[model samples]
Target: MCGTELTIEQSGIPEAIPVEFCYAGWQESLQLLALLTEPEIPDQA
Candidate 1:
């Protein structure tokens, strides 16, 4: 079950999950990080 808000900018452009989301369960944290870094955006962009 996903219960985190992941705004584009809020995800550090696609490499970081919002710190708030990190407060959730351990699984949620991993999921959030995955979702946050899922975008194929270049690391240098």
Candidate 2:
């Protein structure tokens, strides 16, 4: 009931896939948001 809205789309695949996902609580929702919004760090040689 309380969460953010997400839209997903995929292409170049042989079959259609399910795009919608619902989190059971705020903790799970926030965790997902953090993963998505956070930037990735590049590896150093």
Candidate 3:
């Protein structure tokens, strides 16, 4: 096995995956801020 330490943000973006892709439990409607769920908004005049 191979792994390295990271502070999440330093790791940048990861490939998108279904929220229900948890290793355990029924996560059909899961939300994690660390996963960068919020939509990007443009600056309004």
Candidate 4:
């Protein structure tokens, strides 16, 4: 979700609502979310 302004008053939170603490720009931020959500894999011998 991408937009020019931060937020809206009347309509209330447009479709471009980003996840909390995700920030606005920088693709790395999105990647960070993916990494955090990834399941931990056990090491195989």
How high is the CA lDDT of each candidate model?
Answer: 0.60, 0.59, 0.42, 0.55
**TM-score computed on alpha carbons, candidate 1:** 0.31
After best superposition, candidate 4 residue 32: deviation in angstroms? 1.0
lDDT of 3 by residue, 3-39 (tens): 4333322223245844334422232333354346666
Best by lDDT: 1
Worst 10 residues of 2 by lDDT: 15-24
Cα displacement (Å) at residue 28, model 1: 0.5
RMSD (Å) of each candidate, 1 decimal: 14.2, 11.6, 13.4, 11.3
Q: What TM-score does structure 4 among the candidates reach?
A: 0.34
- Displacement of residue 13 (Cα, Å) in model 1 is 33
* Backbone clashes, candidate 2: 0
Q: Which stretches of candidate 3 lie over 4 Å from their true place?
A: 1-35
Model 3 lDDT-worst window of ten: 4-13
Alpha carbon deviation, residue 40, candidate 3 (Å): 0.5
Runs in model 2 lying further than 4 Å from the true structure: 1-24
TM-score top scorer: 2
Which lDDT tens digits does candidate 2 get at residues 1-45? 955686644455444533332223445877788899877999998
Q: Rank the candidates by lDDT, best first.
A: 1, 2, 4, 3
1-45, model 4: which lDDT tens digit per residue? 753333522335456765542445445765686688767999998
Better of 1 and 2 by lDDT: 1
Q: After superposition, how far is residue 8 of candidate 1 from its true place, in Å?
A: 27
